[model samples]
Target: MKNTYIPITMEVEKNYFETSDRMIKTLRLKFLDERFDFEPGQFCEFSILGKGEAPFGIASSPFDKAGLEFSINRAGVVTKAIHELRIGEKVGIRGPLGNYYPVKEMEGYNVVVIGGGFAFTTLRSLIEYMLNPERRGKYKSIKVIYGARNPGLLLYKDLLENWEKRDDIGTYFTIDTKVEGWNKMVGFVPTITEEVAPSPENCYAIVCGPPIMIKFTLPVLLKLGFPKDKIVTSLERRMKCGIGKCGRCNLGEFYVCNDGPVFNFEQLEKLPKEV
Candidate 1:
């Protein structure tokens, strides 16, 4: 059996800043062996020699053959080390670990994607997967509502522009406040979500963002008629070990590292009130 604790080495093919502030960087890693197969919403433990390891969502789609992508925010020591990594440097990847978004179950329904700040990484994976030609026919309408503090903080600007030009999906980009030369909506993510007001009928709404953003957004989704079971979110916070062996990432009886990182509102409700 493949050892979950041992990491495989992969070369960093590309690494660059995602935002103008330089706090967040996107890394593309080339696989040395057969590529690790993973669904969207899954995360991997990224490791650097002497620097330590951290968990981050895989930002590239399953159909993306070039490499695995991770958008990392320079928040702590490991992440700071990750940001300093150069192209051609070797790194360790522990897994396509943890549970993933229910792509198969969501196939027949319309998809509404909501994101904020850098948390949009995995959401991007899900979107790209659903937009692929082979998968497009499986789902109905797709709508995306994303927001960042400012235009400069938005991740994947080029892809967002391309998505805006596509007719197959509806994209709503927003910011926390208005600024000169900005043409997108002016407001927070939850506000924009309420404004976009995607119908919940035969739909699944996937949300990922900071706790504050999600705290307010859930009420809006519920008010707009999304069932608790149909509203999915990722609680990837505080995850140290990517496997369930560590007890740190639990929410009631569920371990975020094993049982989730992804959970519907109905499931979350059953967890401890701290969630």
Candidate 2:
């Protein structure tokens, strides 16, 4: 495929508020048009020039060309700077890079997507593509089990509420600790995931979250008989440049910035276990 390009002058950018702090800050952005080609689960690197760059998934669905969105957490240096930027201030960006979740191969299969806070970003991409009106029959059931540190931390409450009310996909949530105003399940992600175990037969599972949460959840998924290869994931790492040259984020021979920010559990098992 020919390399598609987005000139720096037209890179997507937008303003968003932290509807709450429990999760991460929201970035309202633009994807240009229905013509901007980006596969679900792919990410772009956001740059602040002086401060640095951080990688973020293009969270909003491809179907919504009005804008692209980044669901970011104010974690370290680059992200911290991102959280402070004002609307209309230009931030450098390049790409909708790396492999995206494969919804095409997923056609006609039962699907279960497990996400947490910011990592839930890619899952939204997959869900959006699956739910688009012209694409709905591409998959069977799609279930989401998402959570955060607490009630205040859930990202995209407006979207989640809308998703929860949908008949097409089943959604559930949990938190690491209890919140006074919260009404959903309470416990660590893996704990609750084991309880709400969606079937693995005739299905595929995709998980993205804190490393520790993944550390525990993968085994639970295995126990539930999800095929290791079919258990997909979008790996997380510190990313400076969206391209492969940067050496900061590597797992043995794999560079998270390039070869993948997205990999299946099967691919991950063959790599250095730290991933």
Name the candidate that leads on lDDT: 1
lDDT of 1 at 186: 96
TM-score list, all predictions: 0.98, 0.89
Clashes of each: 0, 5
TM-score of 1: 0.98
Note each model's CA RMSD in angstroms.
0.9, 2.7
Q: C-alpha displacement of 70 in model 2, angstroms?
A: 0.8
Over 106-153, each residue of candidate 1 has an lDDT whose tens digit, in order, gives: 989999999999999999999999999999999999999999999999
- Overall local distance difference test of candidate 2: 0.78
